[model samples]
Target: MHNDLPIRKIIHVDMDAFYASVEQLDYPDLKGKPIAVGGSGARGVISAASYEARKFGVKSAMSGRLAEKLCPNLIFVKHRFERYKEISNKIRKIFLDYTDLVEPLSLDEAYLDVTKNKIGLPSATLIAQKIRDRIFSEVGLTASAGISINKFVAKIASDYNKPNGQKTVNPEDVLQFLEELDIRKFYGVGKVTAEKMYQKGIFSGKDLKSKSIEYLEDNFGKSGKQYYYIVRGIHNSEVRPNRIRKSLAAERTFSENLSSEIFMLDKLNQIAEEVSNRLNKSKVSGKTITLKIKYSDFTLQTRSKTLPFFINDKSIILENAKELLYQDSLKNSVRLLGISLSNLNTDKKLSEEPIDKEKKSVSVQLKFEF
Candidate 1:
């Protein structure tokens, strides 16, 4: 633990294969079966897969054709978003009972700051267990939790013991825990970044910590500074209760690729209508309209036009999208199309200050319990 950092108890709760688990819970026949929640068409992408399906390498974002080849008996189910939201709300209510400082990452995961909880329990580990138990008893779903001094470590720890288990990293063990962690397992290090780190011989946290801040910044830009600090257990980001929506979008993958501009007009209109409906429901409009095109070869392209004023009407969105669609020649047949709005009316100015920007006078507690 750093002497100038603040120590706070953070718990990250992530549900186990939420959508697939929900499906199994609602239908007894689906339980213990290899199930995937998504369309089972030629162009369909799996949204979620059950643990049984995962054993056969069936995973979210995989194509239905490939999943079928991997698991012969894979069952595809449609999404029930409203039901998922209802159950998520119930789980959120349980979190609120313990602490108001809860930051939801998604319907299936959240980060809770329980340094001073409503129940007056000093142990965050116990609170996490009780919350998980309550969720299983009340909502009929299992959740995993990770308890630590900050959000960064807690988020990673939650995955250690998954599918109805929890892990707590005490403050004193934070450094060693991070040092022994794989670089690929670090939250922000994706496949490309991990390969880059591997090229530089930075395979673990200890290896990442061996680099100079100057070297990291020069090589990895802004993210390098974050890596340098997080590896040292100095992440000070607070759990935000009200996370703002950054953008609104609607997209669809077609059963067959559209080769001509004339064939895309109808699909564009439908997508625009969906985006407009979502915007109206959120009661917000945006100045930036973007068109996303995914070709049959899987390459993606985006075109944007920022308007002088915000608009959320389907006709206006379709108009801008059409112009952007014709802005460039198509390299290949289009398989997917999308419309998105950003620079929204709901957006507000927020701070981007780094944790080490200013020094703290009080030393953080090194012996803080999870």
Candidate 2:
């Protein structure tokens, strides 16, 4: 089954604790110490945590108070978006030096297709190492990489050797590598999905492979087919270069939860303005306005309305956001309010052509050199 498709040399590169690492890189005193990038206030959530903090079970998205409880000496730092974007652009430049097929997942991670690279390097492993080396030398940061035949496998392999390391899964080793993988480690399987899989006795890729596709689809819906293909090492998703922006959003977490809709009006206006600014900056507009509300108890709610025409103006955005806010009464005291615009003009159908679509047929190399 694998021999019919064109073999790709894909690499997934992820930075090591990006936000916290950036903070440490700028502040010398923070090196080799537990640090988190985010607010230390009551409503604050940790954006990222350094390796030193991870030893104490501190991690991103954990509450500031809980993180402090876990790591008593955890140092909190504010986020510098412009600084991070500057460093991210530098890293992206390094990626472009090797291949034009770079797909940035975020500020700290990207997928690169170096199957036919500018550098004329046949070995993807060597290319990954070179990229990692350049990142460290040029940007003063460390990254880990995973090299494999496709994006899905490469992404999972990248995490195998993290924090300044790299791993490769050759074509021949792909099936067995996936079979031995814990179901929990499969890229798309979250805790909830893993729990559902466990209920079905799918503890490992091998177990998942035992179930018929019909059985899988019956139990897991659309994702079941995806799992069936993935476990068999058959993901053909391309490394899309120009991934479109699906939405534009901005939100604020307040120091104290606001109890009344009138009190939230000012915050909502500010959030709408931010969203409008971002939409204009990106040169895109959307018809859908979504109001995101996070209550003090951590529950989240979203109200959305799709308009007939796209808009990027602050007044229009604020007006629509206000309508959505009043559409539903307060369920609880709001700790966070957000405004988002979606159904953007930039949205388009991504090409589904195979990586080697121009070629009629291709065979995987026995040894998988790249």
Candidate 3:
């Protein structure tokens, strides 16, 4: 079944430094300091770091030891996913107040379909601003919002101005805004793919759109279609619902980037095992797998390959993940690492690569955040 096409009013909302910000809001003393949430122990990893810390080159998933070196005054605290999750629930409730079509990307971000709403606001831009205000007032956290006609543009607009900022990309402005966009900034353009694009001189949306779709497909494979429309301000993705998730993962952040054998491997094993348990509880099996890695400099990479057979075995999944992990050259100690399983038994695959407003069950992550 295809998602019904609608004249959607999509808004993407992302909290600023979710965990670290929340901690700061809770503890006034940590407000201006570079606070990295995790621990300072040798094995401790940062889950999130304040923007102040980011300036000092301290970031999420960095080792405490390394973070200390980068920012001598960096403060490390333990993660409280439960608190973040509770905050997420509050944010979800706020979105539902605007529309039932809310698609959550993480504990701190979501996409809202506000074509229809309880208050019935006439302007989506106003709606986006109102939501941002509500998040700050009620949740005590700053949020950025993007408002647009479709998901892709809206997602990009939200990040146009970050840290308690918001931008609205009217349909008329979509083309111009996209034209100057860096190909690397486009969602789903990971580190590896970005380097490849740069090598080909596909620096901005204009450069990317210059190449024929055929050439892009030949080079980027399945993701070429996404590259084609994103440059033109078109995205056929949907806002999926909260469902019985087939898989889940827990990643770690070191205070500093790490390339050591013991650090990354141990982290992967931890994430894979968590995913296994989530799958087991959901009683779902998947054939396709993905591994996400973020480097020290905040460049991200993902290596995903599909398997012919579906399995819920943890060992099998972890083993394959381990292989994918070591396959990449040790460029830097990874700051962030995560794993996911797709290709579900009851899978939804779109033949047409565009946003479908009819269905909210399945949607594309649309590769560009490589």
The backbone clash count of each candidate, in order, is 0, 0, 33
TM accuracy, model 3: 0.78
What local lDDT score does residue 115 receive in model 2, on the 0 to 100 scale?
Answer: 92
Each candidate structure's TM-score, on Cα atoms with residue i matched to residue i, is 0.91, 0.89, 0.78
How well is each residue in 1-370 modelled by candidate 2, as lDDT tens digits?
3356657999999999998899899999999999989948888899999999999999987889999999989999998999999999999999999999999999999999999999999999999999999999998999999999889899999999888999999887888898899999999999989999999899999999888778999999999977887787777777888999999899999999899999988998888888988988899999999999999888889999999999999999999999999997999999899998999999887665544322322234545576
C-alpha RMSD by candidate, in order: 2.6, 3.3, 7.0
Query: Model 3 scores what on Cα lDDT?
Result: 0.79
Give Cα-based local distance difference scores for all models.
0.91, 0.89, 0.79
Model 3 lDDT per residue over 287-308, tens place: 9888888877667788888899
Give stretches of model 3 more than 4 Å off.
Answer: 1-7, 243-275, 288-309, 313-341, 350-370
Q: Name model 2 segments beyond 4 Å from true.
A: 212-215, 305-309, 326-330, 354-367
Q: What is the lDDT of candidate 1?
A: 0.91
Ranking under TM-score, best-scoring first?
1, 2, 3
Q: Give one digit per residue, the lDDT tens place, for model 1 in 204-265.
A: 99999899888899989999988888888878788889978879999989989999999999
